[model samples]
Target: MRRALVLTDESARHPFRASLPPHVVRRANEVERMVPWRLKLGLTRKEAESVLATYAAGFVCTLAYFS
Candidate 1:
C-alpha cells in the first residue's frame, strides 16, 4: 500500500514525506496484510472484523453512489 501510494503521487513534491507522518495505531496482520489494525485495547478478532467490515461496506456504498 505504501509503495502504491508513493508510485501514485504524481507531484515531485512528496506531501506525506514532509508532513502527516505515518502513525501505526495497531500492527497489521502479517498473514493478511489487508487487515486494518488490531487494537491492544482488547477488541476480540471477531468484533474487530465485524467493525471493519461494516465500515468497508459503508465506504463501498458511498463510492458506488458517487461513481
Candidate 2:
C-alpha cells in the first residue's frame, strides 16, 4: 500500500483523484452529476474501471470519472 502511494502521487496533477475513501466517493458523486442523463451508464462504467485502477495503483479514488 505504501508503495502504491508513491506510484499514485500524481494526484496533484489530477485533483479528481485522491488517496481517501470519502474523497473518492465524493468525487464519484460529482462525476455522476457531470454526466448527462442520456449518458448515465458512463458513471457506472467509469466507477468500475476507476475502482479497479485505484486498487491497482494503490490509491483509493476515481476523480477521472468526473472528467
Candidate 3:
C-alpha cells in the first residue's frame, strides 16, 4: 500500500524530486490501511509522483487512490 500525499499547484515543485526525506519515507511506509475517501495532503498527482520517485529512487506510485 502506498500513501500518496496529494500535491497542489502551490506545493508542486521540481526540487522535491531531487531528494526524499527519510522520515517522510518512513511515514509513508507506515501507512497500511487506506481510507475510504481521498484525504487532501495539499498536493497533486504529478507532484506526489515526483516526490515519491525522489525518496524511493526509481519507485513509482499510482495516483488513482491517494491520501
Q: Which candidate is the best by lDDT?
A: 1
Off by over 4 Å in 1: 1-39
> Where is model 3 more than 4 Å wrong at Cα?
1-39, 58-67
Better of 1 and 2 by lDDT: 1
- Candidate 1 RMSD computed on C-alpha atoms after optimal superposition onto the true structure: 15.7
Tens-place lDDT digits, model 2, residues 1-67: 3543423334345654544445454566564337675366556767778877879775423545554
Candidate 2: regions farther than 4 A off? 1-43, 59-67
Clashing pairs in 1: none
Ranking by lDDT: 1, 2, 3
Number of clashes recorded per candidate: 0, 1, 6
lDDT of 1: 0.57
* Residue 15, model 2, lDDT: 56
Among residues 3 or more apart in sequence or in different chains, the pairs in candidate 2 whose N, CA or C atoms overlap within 3 Å are 16-63
Q: Estimate each model's TM-score.
A: 0.41, 0.23, 0.26
RMSD, one per candidate, in order: 15.7, 22.0, 23.6
Weakest 10 consecutive residues, lDDT, candidate 1? 20-29
